[model samples]
Target: MLRCHEVTIQVPGRVVCDHLSVVFEAGQVWAVLGRNGAGKSTLIHTLAGLARPAAGSVELQSTDESARGARARARIVGVLLQIEDGTYWGTVAEYVLLGRFPHSHPLMGYSRDDIEHAEAALDALALTTYAGQRFATLSGGERQRVRIAQIIAQRPRLFLLDEPLQHLDLAHQARVLDLIATRAREHGAAAVMVLHEPLWITRSCTHVLVLAGDGTAHCGPADEVLTRERLEHAYGCRLREVDYGAGRSFVPDV
Candidate 1:
């Protein structure tokens, strides 16, 4: 499981979350919701151990033993950021192969199992044909999918995705989310995704964490915490839930 204890995350002149704590269990999906500049990314990074917390601690304890240090932690937590920042001069296949580095020995190359995992991830993301294509040549959406594919290839115990739906069309968004949810359930992995549209927190997510942008946060089961009041408070705007008998839809009150 992945857990944070009284963790405080803050940047210069900006506060994301203060003395916050949460835990993510296997076979569950959690979404982080809030307005822009609400320190969503900062909080995600802190939880993933990519960034240091101002106070307290973040720990990951496997079912049997503990994986200590950065290298061991990397073997368990897979992170995908909002943007693919660095310039890559390699093929899509080559880039995806990097995900296996955590499990490899020093000065080691890709093993047969590693290649197989990368190929499976590529197939799952419908990028098998593009495997030979240059990573830089792919479009924004394509690059985003490849980035996600890399994570799948890693086969980590916990997934940390920040704004994963960026640069994708509606179809790809749904497709990618489906794959993420399926993978988590099948592998008994825990997924924590940062999403912009709270409305898209589909049935796949079991829990939620909403940042109020006021140095506070709220969390609970999805059905209980994803109410209009909580969402409006987090976004600092008025929104209404329209009842359509079978379900409810979230939209602006206007």
Candidate 2:
């Protein structure tokens, strides 16, 4: 499990999220839902260890109390950020191979197992044919797929993805989320992702964490916290939650 205790985050002069606490357990897909500038990305960065919390501690279940939690998180969490600003320099396969850095050796080099894992991840994200293509040359959506493939190659116990479906089309969005869902179940890992699309969250997540302004959360099972009332309260606007079982969807209340 991945947990945050009394976590607070602040920017230069503003307290974005305050005293936030949440737990992500194995066999659960969690959606961190909120509106723009609600500190959703900040929370994800904190959990990923890319940004330090103003005050709080993050813990991984398997580690000792005295163990360095930051280092442990780095090893156990595979993160996908909201943006990829810097240009990538390598091929899709090479970029995916980078995920094995924590386990690779200079002299021994990348093993066959590592190559197989990277290849499998590429295949999973439907980027196999683009394996040899330059990362910088792919379209934005295609690049996002490669990024997801890299994280899949990492095979971490905790997955933190920030707005992972932003640039993806309907088909790729479902495919990618399904891929993450399958991997999390197969490995008994915890998957926590931030999303703006209510329909996707309702359909893809087992647990949902709704973030309101000033750092409040209404978190629970998908069917509970994803209701019209809760979503309107969280996003400060009305919403309509629709159910279609296998093909569930949601729309703006207004």
Candidate 3:
């Protein structure tokens, strides 16, 4: 649903990617893998229209993303930043309810449907029990889950998630991945997530983008781009591949 046309992303002194052209289709989950400072987050921000690319352009559903207004863009794109600096003193439910802002009528306030959506999102992330709790009082992982719930409540066509697995335990991480992948498959949504773990890509991702930290990248179906040699080159390390009943797993050879 989203296409990058010869997009070039740079951060300060470093070039993240140059002339990177790729399409993220509906019903697909894409994993963006790169080591630290590789500009993965920068690439995501550029796609979300939160940052400007150095060259080329991005399109959402064939229209120029920059030409769209903020509210118009919000209706189609949901973005989860790697770091959320804003502080919300409201309750968990109230915080998540904000996600429905794009759909809610400003003068009419939140509708019953909006509340239901927020509640369902909270439940999906296993945060229904904490709905009444204060958002500022939650643990790190709980807060991360809440952030994800907020995005789910938005119900946008495209999900741009940066470091989505941050601060979560293994179980929660698995649940989050499954939830995103299932939503993309069932609702015809598209998700581009910045992830550090390659094993999760084997589990849920349909496509992979590997940034080599030198303004070069590889993008293709997960099976084609997630090979041991490519990952080793992109990550600049040796990775040992092991096969299990479920799928393959990669670990540091050292």
Candidate 4:
């Protein structure tokens, strides 16, 4: 589990994360919901330790107190940012194996277990067929799945994903999101993901953190946070919830 207490992040004249405090509970999926520039991504990065909070701290709750350093933190937390920039040369398997670097023995390279875990992660994401393919050669959705596979191989106690549904077809998006949600639930690892779609958050997340543009948080259960009023308030638009037969969807009235 990860805890953010009274965190504040300032960038020049902007206060991206304003005295924000939240807890990511184990075995639960948390969906961070907000419109663009609402600090969802900033919060994710802060939790991942990529960006230090201007105030307060991010602490990982672990059974073993030994797992408490940067290197140890890498093994305890995995991050899947929206962008995959340095992924041009390595094979899919190699890229995924990089997730094991934090645990690799010095001067020993990757172990047999590391390779097996990497392969299993690829297979879990149905990317085994593309194992030998270079990262640069894969399609957008394929690349996203591959990136997720890498993160899965990390075997972290906590998972942080930013806009994980981006650039993927509906099927792949569902597959990837469902897999993460299921794994987190089964393994008792905490998961925090940023999602643009209200429906995905409703279906996949146990908890929701709705962020408004002015840096206020509406935090609660998924059903409570996914209301039309909350969506309209966070997004600054009128929204209507339409129930058609089996499922419902939210649409902007603007």
How many clashes (backbone N, Cα, C below 3 Å) per candidate? 0, 0, 0, 0
Q: If both were scored by lDDT, which would come out higher, candidate 3 or candidate 4?
A: 3
Better of 3 and 4 by TM-score: 3
The top-ranked prediction according to TM-score is 3
lDDT of candidate 1 over 1-254, digit per residue (tens): 88888988898887788888888888889999899989889888888877899998988868635577777788899999876589899999999988988877767677889999999999988899999999999999899999999998998989999999999889888888888888778888888999877556844678899998988988778888788888888888899787656556588887
Give me the runs in candidate 4 sitting further than 4 Å from their true place. Answer: 244-247
Predicted candidate 2 versus true structure: per-residue lDDT over 1-254, tens digit per residue: 87889888886655766787778899899999887887889888888778889998876676545435544445578999888786678899999998766556657988998899999999988999999999999998999988898888988878899988878989999998988788678878889999888778877789998778666776788877777777787778766667777766668767
- Model 2 earns a TM-score of 0.91
Off by over 4 Å in 2: 63-73, 245-248
Which has the higher lDDT value, candidate number 2 or candidate number 4? 4
Q: Mind giving the per-residue lDDT tens digits that candidate 3 earns over 1-254?
A: 88899999988999899999999999999999999999999999999998899999998883545537787789789999999988799999999999999889989999999999999999999999999999999999999999999999999989999999999999999999999998899998899999988789999999999999999999999998888998888889999998866998799999
lDDT of each: 0.86, 0.82, 0.93, 0.84
**Looking at candidate 1, what is the lDDT of residue 152?**
88
TM-score for each prediction? 0.95, 0.91, 0.96, 0.94
As a whole number from 0 to 100, the lDDT of residue 248 in candidate 1 is: 60
* Alpha-carbon RMSD of each model: 1.6, 2.2, 1.9, 1.5
lDDT of 3: 0.93
- Cα RMSD for candidate 3? 1.9
